[model samples]
Target: MTRRRTTLLTGCTALALALGTTACGGSGPVTAGGGDKALGGQTVTVAGVWSGTEQENFQKVLDAFTEKTGAKTSFVSTGDNVSTVVGSKIEGGNAPDVVMVPQVGVLKQFAGKGWLEPLSETARKSVDTHFADVWKTYGTVDGSLYGLYFKAAHKSTVWYSPGALTQAGVEPPKTYDEMLEAGRTVSDSGLAAFSVAGQDGWTLTDWFENVYLSQAGPEKYDALAAHELKWTDPSVVRALTTLGKLFKDEQLIEGGQKGALNTDFPGSVEKVFGPKPEAGMVYEGDFVAGVAKDQFGREIGEDADFFPFPAVGGGEAPVVSGGDAAVVLKDGKNAKAGMALLEYLATPEAAAVWAEAGGFLSPNKNLDPAAYGDDVSRATAKSLVGAGDSVRFDMSDQAPAAFGGTKGTGEWKLLQDFLRDPSDPEETAAQLEAAAAKAYKG
Candidate 1:
């Protein structure tokens, strides 16, 4: 299809807070108050999908914006339905000045409706200088810049318990076949090999993406993502057939298919890292580290560790990622203040605010590695930033919302069905193609 890929933000949030902020290079602490009063009288309202601890960490970033720029910022949680919440507010003539858009497809929909303002020159230039070209490309739509990606995630990671793996006497696998064999070995050791979050269809989509990107390669990945290649294409069938190798084995999945479908994302992670562990591993984005450490009290490096998703057919492992982008509303009462926030978010200083708080990663290339709270985060961020042109955005996020982002229909539900009965790859592929065709056409 030759279409650009889009990324969406994951639900993981920062749980740990860094001690004192150390000066980086010659700049002072990002949150330190300064005399700059350019926005003394401005009040900017922002909205996003974060809640609980995630919302708190994001507020720290907004607080730093106020300290550095002298603007008062108020934030509201839109919950998981960011598009619907923002749309309703806009229709009511009470939209927030700025929004942290989780899905690139939603950003484009808002921009196409003339609800978004093009980036100010200052914000555009800041993004140009700090972020990589791929990030800039993701934020750009129809040759105009609208969104500035602030938070990013490395989605191609498999978190495993060191103690569980050691107990099974099996090292992390290097290839897909090896991973399947290791899963059987781990299962035989009396622990389920994997904690599959079948209840959350998005996790299943991620499982499919990592496998597709590695087996079908990037060209076919993009084609499938854009709907140029139907889901029933041979490449997709191959990927699904390969994934079936794991799903078909009840011993490899904790609680089996039915049990997996009952587990949510956080519960899946807990199954492996919680006090009385039932599973050996969980596959998801790098955000798993936060849940393991904060909720389960497990150290990231020693207790919970991850390996890149194993390669397929002897090729290099692929990196599939997602991000949250910031955009200003055209009808916002505080457009100036909103634009100022975007500019601030593009700088390494602003990114450092959340980076140091733990559980967050930024695409800002200029950000210092030391800003990350731990070694695991530092290494993951480095891999994300260093991937360059080899990186692929989340495939489902690039598709239309009806097909990709919706909860009960399209890819999410269909994949959940596939997880339950993985015996027929061709039948699943045909059903997926029907849903995708309708979504893309609409």
Candidate 2:
């Protein structure tokens, strides 16, 4: 159950993509200089934090690139902390030709520092054809698209076993309060209701984000992400108080609070899907479909299903999202080759390589729905495109690295404390406000 960095992409069909049909969006397959030479046999180095299966899948992508372009491509896994390793490389003037930035805030930091190279015309055309205007907006800073999303994920889903829910006589809830009631009912049936990955505090942060956005709505969400509203604001307290209901009810969470806190994200999913299932449900991105299939042999739509996070506090639930962006560095080494790889990635042919691999979602609007590994993935992709303008980026990812991305500090640590003891939202909010203030200032 290692969390893979997958996508929340929109797709077109294989025939449309193969025939160079304008019906898909692009005029033809993404290429560099039409039939131009392949970078004179240069090597492009790409750095990312992906490892394990995710790395394996991306290697397939790189391998495909080599087969078509003949330019050697190398990938460097950045371990647990990409910022630390990437920062060191940048400081030492050995920056990778391209870096897959998992956080938009970090990508913006690099762009602001002038460490990124502007997208070449070929890559720009791919972006124009494949992605939506919103993606272009996010990639653009000061009127230039320095980054393009290579992978995206929809984070507003609660994965559950339909048969288990049916046997328990519990229905997927449409509102926050109903969700709590159903959890209690499932718990009464001798199954824990929610599998929470509290050990990795980012999951804890995601929990808060889904609720906060649902309760407070996007205007407030944006203001708060930009620090225009303090964490001590009333909305923060309200969201935390709502979240406390499940955390405080030990029977509602798998293995109780302590065990839940000890379990990582994948283990949380495993608890819900293992042979003798301990829990009935887990909430995460659609990529969990691939995980359940890979680890437990669970079929997505049949064995597992999802519903959007319910509306809370009289407001419509917002679709929370996250993704990885590819940015070429202006470090004067193999820059053209790096851009060429990106241009190729922008094509449906390259995306299909990963799409067929399972667990990945692209932001390409023209990518065919059938290109996905299964119906579950296609449904997730449809939901992402159908989400339209209602989607919002992951809140913490929009905040500065010190406040959100740094492990054991700021939002991560504060939210972990909140999850450990849900009784004092006021105290948690105060601490969160203090940390955000200091981190934003620093």
Candidate 3:
């Protein structure tokens, strides 16, 4: 079992920092627009694993904090977040006031190890209300909340190039059958319908889960992550059959079936931009847009567009995806003040600002969908709200370290082996099931 955190979301670290600063001093929704004047009299040292663009963006928030409250923040840049870095810091007694984690599972893992400070009820309600109760309850240990979410990046949606889609004569796909048909049409029109880099097993794992859960129901994936569901269920097998079927049809994916096994995420990214590219629609999260924008200098709507992971039965589930949470270090400076900041950022006002700036969903429920206003962000928010209800965290992210693919190592190996001989669906299922069992044991 491997719990691999992705590197694609470094941009999110900036969003988290801004939200952290914004979160520090609000009341409740409309009533929550104030900050703590007294807390700023002291300087607090903060450390985290953000760098590059994320750091620049965070500085904006820090500058604002320093300006507003006179609270000086000395942020140490920790290049990458690892358990060893956290352990070493705590053991060295050099803890920061707040630690922003890339995933919820890490937050819970640390909480279980008793390294985090429990936040106030105000902090909990402020951040947690933006998400479903399951997310709020799952990360809490010792009956206390330790982390708060600001930006949630949805992974289950599909991104298509608007110009490419128009060239292919395809409208946004709305159903599984329709999506498959669109894939065929694009293939016939000389472009690959789907483009997913397959070097990481979790990349394919995400596709499998989306297909399985969409065909089955949301509960199945949640239960599976909770150790309450079996891997060899009919739904799981059916999903592989679907994958195999897609494999059998070269028209459905970029560079065909072989490309899926050979194309790394980097390769897939490059493949989408050629003069006569082979792929038009790619199944990826909001972060991919940044990569595209960096490569193409285009804004989201002008270049790429995303639609809700087409409603999967019982209407549509809130656009589900992976997200990060910030925890107050028990041993750090300004514990109460950090909590105040966390509370303040989850307000609608901050959410609107953060979403517009950072290009992700802020954990502020009162924010209007239009306020986010990015074509994808607005569509995502609208689709999420329009769906029957409740947003769910990524099953892979919510699952324990071993069960989740957050670390991104073992799953790629597993996927490499699995794709080589997908002739035996049961074998692949058994292998993943064994890994899931090991995760549960841990």
Candidate 4:
């Protein structure tokens, strides 16, 4: 789970920073019209896990917030380990006015510790109006609203190089078998079929989740996530066995197991779309497009494209997702300013700016699909909204951090082992169950 958290936490730390700065007057959709004096002369400090390009983009958003609300604002980078930094700040009695929590589990933990402030009426109205019920539900703890999701990523996508697919004489795979065949075709053509980021074990967890959700359906996913069902259940075995199809074959993955075990996530995407193009495809969340463009200057639809993770055994596509939530600390110095920021983020305008910038998706139903920068982003946005209530939060994210966020332990290490030697799903399942039991008990 530590690896999972890093994969998502690092990838999204930038987007979270990008959206943390924007705000407007309380009444309506935030526009570039003008400033209001509501929270004027007040400064709001936001602490979040963001840096680099995300930090720069957030500055622009904050500048917009300053222009629209007349509230002086600044953002603080909380580094990679947000929970530790935030907890220390709170204990020091200097908590940021607002904090962007990366996972719902963390938000709930904060709420249980009485460190978060429930949303004010103004923020509640904005959330109710702009977001879907599910998003609201995720942000609520004990029937009180404490967090608002400003950005999200749909994880059910497999990014591919269209040119490579064409060269392999295959279309986007619709079924698991077809996907395997497509991999075979690409491999036969002397290219690695998929870039498995085995070095980052979280990607492997994602690989398992998508297949499980689609193959076993949402009820089982929910049960498994809530620990109502054991990790050693037959469904998990089926999911692992299915995923093993790709992991077991040396030629199917870029650089084989060794290459995968060494390549980090960004490198995995680059392997597929980099200059030499070692592989044809990579599976990750919607954020990959932005990373590719920003890092390697690859054109999404032309140089790279994506399809929903193909269904396993003829089931429908499953959407697994993760996002950042804006939460007010109980000791917030400027409550009005914090609520104003949340109100603004709940609008389509705030989402549009980040969307056009690339690699952001909002659950705000008020957002126009056209706000996304390109067809690839638009498709992901559509898939998210289109999935409706069927969408499931990323399984590892929903689990307790002990099992989900611990490094070189629990799911993270076990999955890496499974990838290195996928000969035994049963043994891996037993290991997973034992780790989960101990973590959940703790």
Candidate 5:
């Protein structure tokens, strides 16, 4: 499945958020702009990565919190790759009350470093019945909250142009051979099929990840992530071979395997929404719903839709990569308000708002799948309904910072590069093993 870009974010593609640290974590009446009540009506600074539709949705949560608490709140647009800035503030003793990021593993490292606080008793108790396994295990380490997840988004789902597929006489693919045939048909019709962008290793990594999930089960990925399994597992080789074949086929990718070398994320996005793009099918996350709606003037399900990533034989599994949890610093002067906003995000109403704005998946399990804005969105929600309930964090986040967190630490790059030449899957596996072994301090 195509995952959206989250890291290596530069100066605010409108996402460089900048809220203040509010009050230190110690004891003191928190301060707000004008008159104040609890915590002395103090204001709290929060930071996270969200600009376009994402920011609008988040604002809804903030707006509700302000109305309920009567606390004045404003935000600075923090760019992606939050750790670069937030991590420094934390080290400098001035981290914001709350921080939002996309990858769960990054937050786990911070929690492990002792930079976070356990969720308030009220918050922790509320989450047990409200979230899925992904949020619980991915966000928590040592039973503490580093990531306060608010939604669920899965990849490994393919979004194709139904009309194009039909016009090209290509049926929705159900098997690996069918998928290849579909791609070929689309190509023969002078239209692109897969909208994979490999210039940046991130997109390519997603392809490899999807292959791994389809070839093996979630258990294989989990074991590999934890360094309990070797990368050269037969399943791994088969998946890589599949990807390599696609790259070898000029008809499979837009601009071919080499074309992926220069494809930027936004560019690939445009290829889908723009009138004359190379491809018609893109495997992306919920976030793209807005991009399609606003840019292509189509709401999810109505304009664009998604289908489960097809598996070969008994390779079916429910493997989804989701966002990081929102965590509040323990000492921020307005910890009370921080917690309030954090909890506010978990509500059904908040989930609805997020769905409305950015088309992100909601962590609030209470959200009615019926509430999805379009057919595509609803279909995606429905696809997950019949699958197992387990969600895996993205592989990139499972390693130490040196591997990939606030930066591209080469963990995913290896997968992307090796997928094109999978003959030596064992060697590639060995490299990942060695990398993890060297990076693992525990």
Candidate 6:
């Protein structure tokens, strides 16, 4: 929900800009031989939420594209507020050739406004061959293929320091209650039990989502996402109460509520994996492993490891996920080049470029497992692609931006407030219902 937008030059392009190279191309799996230059003299622009290392990794994929097609590509970061920045660009007649949409709600909104171009036949064919039908289903809006999900994050894993858990003499928990007990034991051993990123309201939504999915089952989860069931329903209250059990105990949190409310996403991960760790556990997407390894030099499956979020009340544990979709903009100047780039992204070759770089997962079934840099990433990618209908997308992403994606209002802000004062589930549920009703109607 950050509103800061920054322009980032692709790694190859940055070097090219400095050294005056002819093209931002590299020899990799996606390279086309025999000096193929079908896309020569073309330039494609992309905008997305990825920044820092993520942006750098994605640029490798673009570099591969340039190698194969002889077309140049540039990337810009829209920060977390993809909808606002991209929307403003469209109105100003300066839309990028392609945009990486982070939320399904935003994709649908853009398509409804006629701002997105349907996928080209070549792109659709690649998707059909490489991706699961469900991935395509998410990309389609009103029977038209408009977005292709290229990056996915498995959100149900809880990462922890293996050494810290061993010191506390507790195994990975199998149930929500068991996890809390382990937290208490770990806390008693002179370390904070969990590093909760309460400042980023979206993280709190994920906490509520995993609990709601496990407790209420898939049917209720779908209904709640669609707003067919009001937020004030008993199921919502039950889920809130379940999450409150973790939040209500300030001792279990790394820096208590106030400290957590000030920590951003990366800071929360640092609390558990930094050189002088303050907490034993951190919960989020599989990307947490990337943060630990890249920033803290902790190896996955050794210093850093994870387990599925524990089941609630003996039900099957849920696999909640989030992904970024690549869509061509209808009003962009480089439509042909944009479609070509989208088509290439659908191929296994493009996916491998990032998978091999670390901290990435692809839903493309055709991509080789060996492309992943580590065993943990490979296994997690396999689980996600094989999850079938059992996997549920992020709940907040399904709602309108006003309710789900906004920084300080609606679900994000409300959940932050709940974390601060979780004594009354019913009151929280009622407030959520009021906000959701207004959001869904608008």
TM-score of each: 0.91, 0.89, 0.84, 0.91, 0.84, 0.89
Ranking by lDDT: 6, 1, 2, 4, 5, 3
Candidate 1, residues 8-42: lDDT per residue as tens digits? 11111100011112222234333444535556777
Q: Is candidate 2 or 4 superior in TM-score?
A: 4
**Candidate 2 total steric clashes:** 12
Q: Write the per-residue lDDT of candidate 4 for residues 15-68, one digit (tens) a residue.
A: 123234233233444445454444568798888877887766666666667667
Which is superior by TM-score, 1 or 6? Answer: 1
Model 5, position 287, has a per-residue lDDT of 54
In candidate 3, stretches whose alpha carbon ends up further than 4 angstroms from where it belongs are: 1-36, 77-80, 128-134, 273-276, 311-318, 370-373, 385-389, 406-410
Please provide, for model 2 over 95-177, each residue's C-alpha lDDT reduced to its tens digit, 9 standing for 90 to 100: 79889888878888888877887776656767887777777767778888888888889898899988779888988899978
Clashes of each: 0, 12, 17, 4, 30, 0
Report model 4's TM-score to 2 decimal places.
0.91
Q: For model 2, what is the error of residue 11's alpha carbon versus the real structure, in angstroms, after optimal superposition? A: 24
For candidate 5, write residues 16-75 as lDDT tens digits: 011111222222222222312332265757787778766777787676556545655666
User: lDDT per model, in order?
Assistant: 0.84, 0.80, 0.63, 0.79, 0.63, 0.85
Of candidate 6, the 10-residue stretch with the lowest lDDT total is 1-10
Q: How many residue pairs of model 5 clash at the backbone?
A: 30
The digit string of per-residue lDDT tens for model 3 on 8-124 reads 111222323323333334434432223344444766565666777766666655555554445676777766554557778878877776776766667778887777766655555
Candidate 6 residue-wise lDDT at 263: 89
Screening candidate 1 with a backbone cut-off below 3 angstroms (N, C-alpha, C), the clashing residue pairs are: none
Evaluate model 5: give its lDDT.
0.63
